[model samples]
Target: MKINPKNGVDQLVFGMKQNHVENLYGTPDKQFKDEDGNVIYLYNKEKLRLTFYEDEALRLGYIITSNSEATLLDQKVIGKNIVEIKTELPFKSWEQEDFDSTENHFNESNWLILQSEFDVIIRVEIGAIINDNDEFDWKFKA
Candidate 1:
């Protein structure tokens, strides 16, 4: 899968509706609501989880993949260590989570986040970028 920072992963652009997603990937292996009530659709075999905003719009707000084949900026990041990812992506200007030193999640201004566990990347996620006013600026409006 291809990752586009602040936009989407592959063809799943931000703000797409449920039907659009279903059309592209078929039904999810499992579907449930997260703690915040957002809808989460998990594709077990792909190790992909898509989160949709809860409202009349029900737009896709997040894309996450644990697939080892996923790539970002032409660099394969899954299963790589933080140091390797930083070097490959040349992860400049990424803001590290300061709340806990043990946490290895790093987020850029664009909202492309690399989540690591024990120094190894376990997940790659892309979502809408926060605007200057601190509001989500969705790339698509469908």
Candidate 2:
């Protein structure tokens, strides 16, 4: 599927309603609220985690995956380094730590973050985060 950062994963969009998500992905494998009150729709079979804000809109905030089979458009994402990844999906502006620095997953410093209208983060030796702030307070929220 084509991964459009501005729109969303395939047919999904940043401001799309929860029903739209259900229509696109079907029923979630699991659904729960995070500590901060965001609703998480976990599709274990699909290996996708979709998090929505806790407001009237309930807009999508985060799209996360650790699945190696997942791809952004035709680009294979999992386990690839920044250089190889860039060749597939080149980003102009990014935030990252020193290559030799120890990982800090909580802070997400180990990943290379490309924050535009949407936030696309590629983790070191792991997965990726395709996020959208939308009406959220910060550009990049936890």
Candidate 3:
């Protein structure tokens, strides 16, 4: 499914209440707080993470996952190679960071900061993605 700001990433979006999410997906497998004070709901079995803001109401902040349905620009990203993703998404510009592949982790891992028309910064990891507000300073930090 195409990622929509109103509909949210995959199944949830910002401004959605925590209870509404619980009702839709049932209780999360586990929950934890991130260093940024966001509440992260982890469904390990599904490889999904729903993060909520630190407000008392717990509004959805972002969604991080490797779910097959969590797509951007019509690309079915889960399990897809980075090359395939690069082909499907029309990223205006990007910043890439490479990770050293070790003996224990032989796969070549990298991070791509995909800047899109949606005005969101998509952090594309080797096997997962983190979609959040574009706090990237386009003029200075890019």
Candidate 4:
């Protein structure tokens, strides 16, 4: 499935309500709030976690996947190193951050974030695009 940056994964867009997603994905294995109070819907079978922003009526904020079969720009990303992932820089640029030695690289232009462990990408996330007002871009609404 193509990860549409600032839009969503496949047909699921950013401003879609939880019920809309549930209609397509069925019930999540678990639904709860995160430390920051963002609603989270976990699908253990798919190894996917979806985050929703509280300010936007719980519309999807981002998608996190550890699925080994997932690909970015038609290239396998999970388990690949930064050097490998950069073989073709899909975005213009990205900013790197470190947490407890774990590396996180994010590009605001495309809203993609990669979390790496031991130099290997352990997870990939695509988030909602924020507008000039610092709000989720509801343009992708269903």
Q: In candidate 2, what are the lDDT values of residues 1-142, reduced to their tens digit? A: 3444444555555655678789878989899999988888987876667778786357775666655655554776555554545555545444444444332222232223322111233432211333355333222222
Which of the two, 1 or 3, has more TM-score? 1
What TM-score would you give candidate 2 relative to the actual structure? 0.62
Which residues of candidate 4, in runs, are more than 4 Å off? none
For candidate 1, the lDDT comes to 0.80
Q: Which segments of model 2 are wrong by more than 4 Å?
A: 97-142
- List model 4 lDDT by residue over 24-104, tens digit each: 889999999988888999988777889888877788878988888777777878898976786576686889999997889
Q: Which candidate number has the best lDDT?
A: 4
| Candidates 3 and 4 compared by TM-score, better number | 4
lDDT string for model 3 (64-121, tens) is 5655565666666554555556655655344444444311111222222332222222
TM-score of each: 0.86, 0.62, 0.61, 0.89
Clashing pairs in 3: none
| Better by lDDT, candidate 4 or 1 | 4
Please rank every candidate by TM-score, starting with the best: 4, 1, 2, 3
| Better candidate by lDDT, 2 or 3 | 2
| Least well predicted 10-residue stretch by lDDT in candidate 4 | 133-142
Per-model C-alpha RMSD: 2.5, 8.0, 9.8, 1.6
